[model samples]
Target: MGRGLGALIPDFDEDKAQVSELQYLAIEKIVPNPSQPRVIFDEEKMKELADSIKCNGINQPILVRKIDNAKYEIVAGERRWRACLMLKMEIIPAIVRELTDEESLQIALIENIQREDIGPIEEARAYQQLIKRFSYTQDELAQKIGKSRPAITNAIRLLDLPDEIIEHVISGTISAGHARTLLSLSVNEDRINALHKIINDKLSVRQAEDLVRRSMEIGKVPTPAKQAYVFEKESYIKENIWKKFTFKGNQKTGKFVFSYSSPEEKQELLNSLGIQ
Candidate 1:
């Protein structure tokens, strides 16, 4: 399909439903619905379910909408759809359900989220969809999902990430911890750069966080090297000749002076170095 979700799955099936209730079942047929929004199925879990289906022979059917003679849209159980596909079964058991676009999306969101398995990017997309398509407020979404406003806010923030970083995070090139650390960076470009560095350098989450903190601290300095250069020059005299001379300087090197004490110190220096 050369599209976003298509990269995850070459194709998807929507022909059947995993037998719910009468309200759930509307029809029974197999159609490959490629437009389904939910992608990124967990492979390990799919294998487990595939084993179960092999033993019990698909105990439950899935709910889907008829797209046409040979295609159908999934209303729920995308995971089941993926598992069945992996099982390589010719047909899946399903009941058809006719739902409005909004209803189907809501169901999809609830289904994926309830599993606690949706990726941050997909979850953020679903949240944005709810907001843009259905005019859902953050508070409303929070209330609907039994979460706090800050939780909702943070979840939505995932959408602000650059597409490349998001793809990296989704593809497991970087961890979620690293992704969150990158998100903490205020600038989008810097965040993206850090993301690339994290992957390239294989930096840990803590390392990424420390790098961000250092970057912020460096950002705060005023004429940083200007102040540092003066300090270094003045400290060099004291560091190299502390036993022989004392030195001091003001904000610039022009004020530096090397000092010696009375004859007693001068004689002590000569004695120490055997320079008598």
Candidate 2:
């Protein structure tokens, strides 16, 4: 057992319970923590760890909570358990503790966050789950996780993004910084447009922010009566044809700009509008 796990359990007496006396249980009986924040595991790193375990064996005992006489839920060391499973290890050294669900979730979150193993979105989702499931306020969550209130607030705000953009963040297609910038656009259509632009243009975080800000400002600009008809026409197009296009100029002289990443998408848009 590592000193880290020993620190969590006050009754751990290494001298009384020799290293050889540590409890070793069948690997199959242990289940992963439902509240585990880390979803993606680096396969290369896991393979490396597995190879090392094959040579030297797991140095630390995994921490688990007894669910029943025959069942256990891992509180920490899921990565180690995974590595051991990779090596086809039958039995694993473990320490069982009596823990509540809240304690289990907190410990799991702290372990992953401390190790920096979880992604930003994963961390946000963990915070959200903690708040929703445990009725934790933002301030309370911030204090518990050693983060500031604004940091906690921002993390939870990430959930407001559409599922498509959230998928991009989770998949590493765009960074958390980029996602934060997109939050400036309140409209879903505007946010989705900005997301496409970011991916297609490989826009930096600052650039994405500037682009969204400029677009928002343009939308907010006051229109003169001469241009009111043009703006109304633009609104109609946006509401009916596509909300992603840009309309400029006036009723007498106006330009409509439509952007598409591919010819296929352009053709699809044209087909949707009954245009050849």
Candidate 3:
């Protein structure tokens, strides 16, 4: 069996192996780790990094593990490597260490987390991989990554969202906050409906929460005066404001919806209505 990360790094001192023994390896000989936790790299950011590298060169060396006498697999600094590759750099500085699959994944995950480059969904997937592949518990994974156990638990919970919702979270269409709000709904259909409303109305996290709460209260007895007042407000908004507008609720419970195709359109609609 392969050894755990502690056996290889011993308090992560090995990460600093580059300080004394940095070596310049041919870029062509190094490859990205297949188990790398981060899947998305911002192209604009990569271009910016490449421009900086062209001006100043790589200030930090990449971390790699010797795959064979002739090849190396990157354990960290894949973004730097990509930037260097964009500049067609012939050779790049690196620190090569011997690592098992587990060590490589742990290092990659830690590096990405430290850099804040990986998204929440990707982070959840990484935690899932560690649990399934390495038989790690939530507490153990949290300890390995220096996160609180509840944080790890919450991240993994994101995977239970529908694929469509997960795509929105990954694409920055909705935030992790909005995703968590959706999770509070017990029905999948309600969750999906709320997701549509969130994107269509450009709901903020607080608004999303209110929408979930109102949806949950749908079948309950309505307060007559409050319901009538809310209905009047919805009627007024629909007639005087946006034709796509919708309002649902009773006295203390209600949600407003205004649909738009894009953020620019939404802003234009708000501006047209003299709303800030």
Candidate 4:
């Protein structure tokens, strides 16, 4: 998925330019990244920021890159830009730097992460986008972002989940932990069942994982082919020797037996099976 799409977008990394001077630009002229990872912003939080800017004003300028003579693409501080727009500001302070689309994406992802602006799902999607658009291997991307590889892998796994379950994570119906636990269930129905139980009973992440493990164990009963072979071996000892029987194991190794009443009964039973 990544390599195919990555070709359409130009990509590279150069020495990052430092902020030297602030450039105030028209809000109308500046645009948001079409691939912005964050989809949800807290309404109350936006209001608070807008109110703050209304009175105290923006202390830190936004970041942008010139796309054309009159247009700029936001590289970071989208929330600030949006708030300024909320207040209907004509022009706002920004730091302009030349950046490739790849650099712009990486910086945007990092900035949102540092600010805790995006949720776990959004973070995952952003990581996925970075990898997809720029053809980054998971490990390569992890190194680029200074994250452990497992963190990147786990975040990407969330996207494997069903959309319903994904929405649950988005809506705060479940934590990212619970969603990952749900990923453990290979079957869609099992995942849905586990999700239902998680929400209905309010199960913790550990409990939800336990539920999946237990379900897997129940499903791991010996295959009928193996069971039939074991039962056939038991037939060799004595056909219909006893009404009650027990068997445990698989093809290479296992146990088969029935209880005897007493010492005499045990000996008689063994003798009946042609034991010395």
Top candidate, metric lDDT? 3
Off by over 4 Å in 1: 1-28, 32-35, 66-72, 88-91, 220-276
Best by TM-score: 3
What TM-score, over all chains together, does every model reach?
A: 0.62, 0.68, 0.72, 0.68
How close to the true structure is residue 240 of candidate 4, measured as C-alpha lDDT? 57
Model 3 agreement with the true structure over 39-67: per-residue lDDT tens digits: 55666787898899899988888888889
Residue 165 accuracy (lDDT) in model 2 = 83
**Residue pairs with backbone overlap in model 3:** none
Q: Give the TM-score of candidate 3.
A: 0.72
* Candidate with the larger TM-score of 2 and 3: 3
The deviation in Å at residue 153 for candidate 4 is: 1.4
**lDDT value for model 4:** 0.70
Would you list the rank order by lDDT, best first?
3, 2, 4, 1
Off by over 4 Å in 2: 1-21, 220-276
Local accuracy of candidate 2 as per-residue lDDT tens digits, 222-274: 22222122244644665587644666565578778764432344576788679
Candidate 3 stretches with Cα past 4 Å from truth are: 1-20, 219-276
Error of 4 at 120 (Å): 1.5
Rate residue 203 of model 4 by lDDT: 81
